[model samples]
Target: MRKVFITGTDTGVGKTLISSLLVKKFNAYYFKPIQTGSKEERDVNIVKNLTGLNGEYFLPEVYLLKEPLSPHLAAKRENKKIELKKIFCPQKEPLVVEGAGGVFVPLNENSFMLDLMQKFSLPVLVVARSTLGTINHTLLTLEALRQKKIDILGVILNGPLNLENKNAIEYYGKVKVLAEIPKLKTINSMGIEELLTNFNI
Candidate 1:
């Protein structure tokens, strides 16, 4: 059972893509505890499409906010409070959990995504971009995770391979570079399956 929480440096940094890859790699259930988006824009649907997996591999989100904003704000708009106590990992093992944004994003007025990561207490694998300005974003993310005493598996650089960025992240952050995924011409199950070969997670 290889369970990991996949977070990113920020939103749209390929967290869902990495989650899909890991779900396929380990044949694990994909769980995104809090999703803040419209009904049609769910990441779980995208993951299910990419992995071409059945419903059993997916778990229902605890909070599915209709607004596409941060968890706290989205929940507020709906007049709902995001409670930590209501969240529980499924009985299924080898799960791949994904956070709703960057680690610092607030889940409520007081708690942050970092707190959710702590609640899950699973090892994290950060999905970062392989481009300019990534060094700073990645280092800060790593520091925050360390501050919470979270176990980090390493980083997965999503995008074109940039040796400079990769070396800097590994050297300065003192974290391993698990994989470097280049841009894909076509994103589907076949592409995801092929890309899984290059991953070391």
Candidate 2:
């Protein structure tokens, strides 16, 4: 199975958006390792809405946290510890693992999102905004992935408005831009079917 880790340059960079689309495209199982904020605001709901892949696809041990802060701080406030083992369980099909916030976001006092990714041992698919300053963030994220010896399965640049940002990321980062998704687009099953057809997934 083709398991992939989905992370973003920062929060609100559409990691859930791209991850849901990927789950539909590849017909893969979706897993959100750790989700903070309320249950309604979690990415698993969005993924379920988009893919209609049944409850089996969404794997999250701790569903809701009161605060929308980083997982570590939120867990601390709630007197809970983020369990890494629960997040690294095996899935029957290809798994699309979504990370909270950015690559370096803390999950505990000594562990971050990168540490979780390393534990999972999944290839990464970076979802970055297609705007100014994206190049810097993307590059830094790429370097972090490299340092951790994580396999990067290219990038998916969200919000396809800035051609310049896209060009810079491709030129400097030297990674394939797998897909450039525009903002405010409705990607249903049909759209996902088309993407799978095109990519021969």
| TM-scores for all predictions | 0.96, 0.88
Best by TM-score: 1
Model 2 scores worst on lDDT over the 10 consecutive residues at 192-201
lDDT of 2 by residue, 76-142 (tens): 8899888776665465578888889999998887888999889988889999998888999999999
Task: For candidate 1, write residues 1-201 as lDDT tens digits.
Answer: 478899999999999998988888888999999999865599999999999889989999999999999999999999999998899867777899999889999988789999989988989999999988899999999999999999999999999989999999999999999899898898899989888775665
Off by over 4 Å in 1: 198-201
| Per-residue lDDT value at 25 in model 1 | 83
Error of 2 at 84 (Å): 2.8
Q: Residue 33 error for model 2, in Å?
A: 1.3
Give every collision pair in model 1. none
